[model samples]
Target: MPQDRTLLYAGRGFEVAHVRLHAPQGPVWSDLYTVASPRVVFPIGRTRLDVRSGDDTWLTDALTAIRFGDATAYRLRPETAAVRHSLVVSGHASVGPTHGASTTGVSVCLMTPQALYRMHAARRQLPDTDGTQAATLVASLVAYLAGAPHQAPWHGAVARARQLLLSEGSGPGTRVLSLDELAEAVSRSPFHLARRFRQQTGLSLHQYRQHLRLASAMERLADGERDLAGLAHDLGYCSQSHLGAVFRQAVGVTLGDARRVLGPAGTGASASARI
Candidate 1:
């Protein structure tokens, strides 16, 4: 059986897919995106991949990060991995890849292991709708790869507040924290925390939590879960209808439509499934 394609996060402007490919007898080519969207691919193993767009092709190794923009179409051919895990992001700002002297259209940049670890750590700390932090991390990674100046620093208090929020809302049966509680945890007044959080992450704490809830619900639904009421209750929505309203607003599609797109559980591959 193929490995499951898990959508780690998805929101209005960005989405992330965790892809694992099982044993391959030969180089495997997979269609990545049809529409023009900026994408970053981080291969988690010592594998070689050729990213192709039209006649332009770039070669990337496991440790390198590749960025592409204005690509009409793209495909990935992975070599030499029996089981490979890669994190791919779409719809973020496009940065040019570091290219070899001979290769054109793709740039390869060395990413430090520590930086990669911090990126994932920060991602795991963010609520689902808080794509801003994730995007920032990616952009920073790109800048670092391109030998550019880093972005402004995140305030220490706000960073701690974000971690506290993530701890509260990330696990199963976890309850979200009230703004007052979060503020107290970070030693800030609620008003101050809210203001700083918005400035740092581009979303209020409440909005971020809601995005996390909706994202959790969407993952369950995509995994072939039924019982909307149970999902709503588990995720702390007031009611099933409330979940539906929020889902439609955040996803720009009805739950039914999303389910259809996701297909029947255990039978269909996710939209981001590796071919």
Candidate 2:
């Protein structure tokens, strides 16, 4: 696979890089790779990473970020063909202990647009920041994610249903599914699916779908998507203004502001496109 990684800044105890991983033409899974230092990775846009750690495997998309301790080894396969972008921060002092690490010292966190916005702002300042300020900004994000709430476990039909939503949601043309449609796909009654989905994910199907739609919109905007109308339509919004309304409600910024501040300066956008 062809890859491009550019070092954006290197401060005293920390460094930041923008990495782009293109889809491979041959084998689906790439060869194993190891991290020499503790680092946190934020996936952008429609990026989909299927991570293999030890005997376990899981997927990380626009809705998630992953942290790995020194010497951690893993393999990756792209779940989508879109070129994946990620922001990598390494050599931060907060590397001592990270939240939600499994036996391999790799932890996954669910990310929000607000969190991503904060990170993007910090990252955009790296070039002008002194080493101390740089480390502080990057470590702040790590600390914030460390304190976030853990996800409730989802199993059986609920798990499958969640996957279906994520898979369908993380793309250019997102497919909307009603409760009945999702229930049918998961082979469960509508009531059972709805009730169990909320029980496991703490969100109704409608709410979760909305979360995904907004996430997808954020991902695209961060990737320098300027066509509000096109983006809104592709993500199932009624119109550009409708997307702006919900975006402001959820992200606390107008679409134009988000684009100017968060989109494609150097760092990858937040996770949600893959959520």
Candidate 3:
């Protein structure tokens, strides 16, 4: 009489949770899976969303839907900066192109089912009174995905600085622009720009630059190329050991260890190997 829940994705730093509905006469499982990205967002027609995780409960009426965003858009921060939030889609829902919808508003990079379930339980006790429970849940999710208190404003020089970080390759990778050049490109005073970059992105210009460098390293490691030393030098590390120290301190693991774990799984084991 009820739909079946499922685990769509699981990784080192992310996980996607899902539930499929086959209303006796509704869409068939084949029709549902045939959609573009088997891993995508689904919209609710007239059904309700009833989520129950542990001690939490969240509900939503028709009109609530799910979608995806680019995980490559993630910003690097201190490991201690992670913020956890819960997502629960109520009622008939489906998948789309890619990514999953946490709240109708936020795009959560599925962390862990255990974590999601826990948050679901917490959400139940905090339903919205404005009749837009779905919106509330999603808003909370978006905030969490945004690095919480570190969510960069949509418009600001610092935000622009962060945009620069996530866009294309930089520093150790292919970005040829230097700090002063980018500051000039953004038309902000270097001193002021550095301060704002710190306030907004939660790191200095130099530090965020390292973030990009680290991201690039992770990508290389995931390739399973086995050129750790070459990858390090190419990514701007003074040497293999230099990259190893920074990578371990920032990513929580050694370059070799991450490569072995990811083994081409694309699980962000690369992220953990980055400097």
Global lDDT scores for all candidate models: 0.56, 0.69, 0.42
lDDT of 2 by residue, 24-143 (tens): 653288888988888888765556567776765656656677778788888887866668888888887765235555676677766776666656555555544453444565678877
Off by over 4 Å in 3: 1-104, 107-147, 163-176, 265-275
Q: Which ten residues in a row are the worst by lDDT in model 1?
A: 266-275
TM agreement with the true structure for every prediction: 0.47, 0.80, 0.45
Reference-based lDDT, residue 246, model 2 = 85
Q: How far is candidate 3 from the true structure (C-alpha RMSD, Å)?
A: 15.9
**Arranged by TM-score, best first:** 2, 1, 3
What clash pairs does model 1 have? 97-107, 98-107, 98-108, 99-107
List candidate 2 stretches off by more than 4 Å.
96-100, 127-136, 150-156, 169-175, 195-203, 263-275
What is residue 80's positional error in candidate 2, in angstroms? Answer: 3.2
- Candidate 1 lDDT over 1-275, as tens digits, reads 15556786676466767777664655767755553565666655444555666665555544446655545466667655566666677775444444332133444443443444434433343334345555556556555655622111224667677556544644446666888888888899999999987775556777666655555565566456777788778777777788888877766666665555443432222222211
